[model samples]
Target: MTPTVISPASPVELLHYMITYQRYPTTLLICSSDDEFRAAIAEELKGQIPEEQLQQEPDEFGEVIIDHPLAALPIFRRVVARHLRVLFVPSVIHLRAILSVFSQADSPIPPPPEEDSENTKQGARPRPPSLFAYGFLELHRDSSEWSAQGLSSSASMFVAAARRSGFNPVMVEPKAAGGLANFEHVLREHAPILSGGARRDEGWQGRTVEVRRVFDRWFRFQTGQWDIKWPEDNAS
Candidate 1:
């Protein structure tokens, strides 16, 4: 499947597309660093789809809330198998972790056996079936705090990662509710390809792994200066 990019005109239209095209037994992971955007998407989805179709609590709307992506690694397979409709992850950090897990699904590295454990005594536990087939959607909110270049670069990284992992990822940047019509118009133009009816040209070409490594190193190096300055601050 060819990777495609979607620029939804508004959040409402984006939610509509998500609810309309979401297939059964394949969960839709909506990830973003902005809590407000995440909640907004969830609220929009709840309003659009039937309440009974969703998984909610007695007093609150029930949705699978993942605090961290790495934490979900162990049960991701089970969650996908159950055919969850929507999952809310708080950050792109978690998204990266999930992508890494799926990309490495083919050759999972099992943990070392415990010393004299019952399971180890008999044999190592069998690895779970790969859960690489699932849909991913990223909704990037234009942050006033982040530069335009930063947002573009971040989006590019996501596009690259999705392409490398063979996922037809969809990304939308909805400026406001009033823009729904324009967003829907764009979606209609790309509906055929998004629905697997047509193949779009490849526009992303980058190694997500390498980009992540560079990002991590840069982050560490930038933050490491804090440790170096801590001593000076205390002395003064």
Candidate 2:
């Protein structure tokens, strides 16, 4: 199928195209920041998300600069990719996160504006020494070595890399939020296609596998094909 970029004057038009499109399979709406998207979606599609569920607070990294349209793109891509369909629209953050290699001690991307206060309170956190820094710092410290294949133990590293690139990742939740285990549960339920990691020496491929599964499950859950273990994952 052809991959053509669609541009419209507003987020409503974007969502309209996404909901109506038959060929694309999955649609992603991305913007530079989240507030802009949230405002647009609220204006255009008032009830897409409930008022109480939206995350009003910024993440420690200040990545909340992304809006709903842009945030939705990665989730949409993850879902569509799992269905073996080409992703529609492009989220700068999602694209950069998945495409870039991991490194430890990589410099931290500027925090989102909403997170400045948190940063001040936390003081200056040293940047990871490598591209896999997030992984090393959050998920797997010792095993933080960058592996271009498999689901490397450092999911945080991938998230951090995206943050470093000035992109906010819109996953169901932060691993610290107990989302990883929830994601694991979702993966087990769906019976997703998992590549053999150690055998193929494709740890990075495994990472993509996990990401795709999470997206697939999330989309399915949204469409009523599966039940979400926790509603919070779908809320914000």
Candidate 3:
């Protein structure tokens, strides 16, 4: 199935929709070559979303960190078990590496043999469940049509990998002509509403409907019923 491209009208609208309409287990994972953008997003989401809902890759304890992407399989399995809904990947390179791991049809090597005798007294570890209705964030340098095409190619690769790994993936890229400043502005504007105890505007509901339409398109695209065209360029 061809992947559908989504270009949100604005960052504020996207955040509003995510916070208001997204289902439970709504965790966002941020990964980047540097932590600047991730830090910015975390700062913006401070009062808006609960601190527990946002998580960083590698984590504070360095438990999930891995030198090779394939080594992260256990971590990915755990994240899926936890039912994380959103993953904000800022680094294109990191995103590609993760996708490569998922693209594998099956494990290349056999599982380690179970311990004998004494180990039989202990129970085996539980496995992670399948992921569903998950979202991924992609940040680009500009909003040009050329950039959009490049993003489409990346999204296609991501969706294909996710499907192969037994996940239903939806990619979202919020429009911000003014770049980071614009994103900050939008988040600030909606901070009050996101913090709670305020009536939601009718316009926010309208935007939610619009965003839902985008997700519907993604769902339809996954079925291969739609004649969506994928770019020749494939993300490695």
Q: List the residue pairs that clash in candidate 3.
A: none
lDDT of each: 0.37, 0.33, 0.38
* lDDT per residue (tens digit) for residues 94-167 in model 1: 55555554442342333224423634556575322211211122232222212223333544555455556555
Query: Pick by lDDT: which candidate is best?
Result: 3
TM-score of 3: 0.35
Q: Evaluate candidate 3 by giving its C-alpha RMSD to the native, one decimal.
A: 16.7
- From the highest TM-score down, the ranking of the candidates is 3, 1, 2
RMSD for each of the candidates: 20.1, 17.7, 16.7
What TM-score does structure 1 among the candidates reach?
A: 0.35
Worst 10 residues of 3 by lDDT: 189-198
Q: Could you estimate the TM-score for every candidate? A: 0.35, 0.22, 0.35
Q: Locate the minimum summed-lDDT window of 10 residues in model 1.
A: 218-227
Candidate 3: lDDT over CA atoms?
0.38
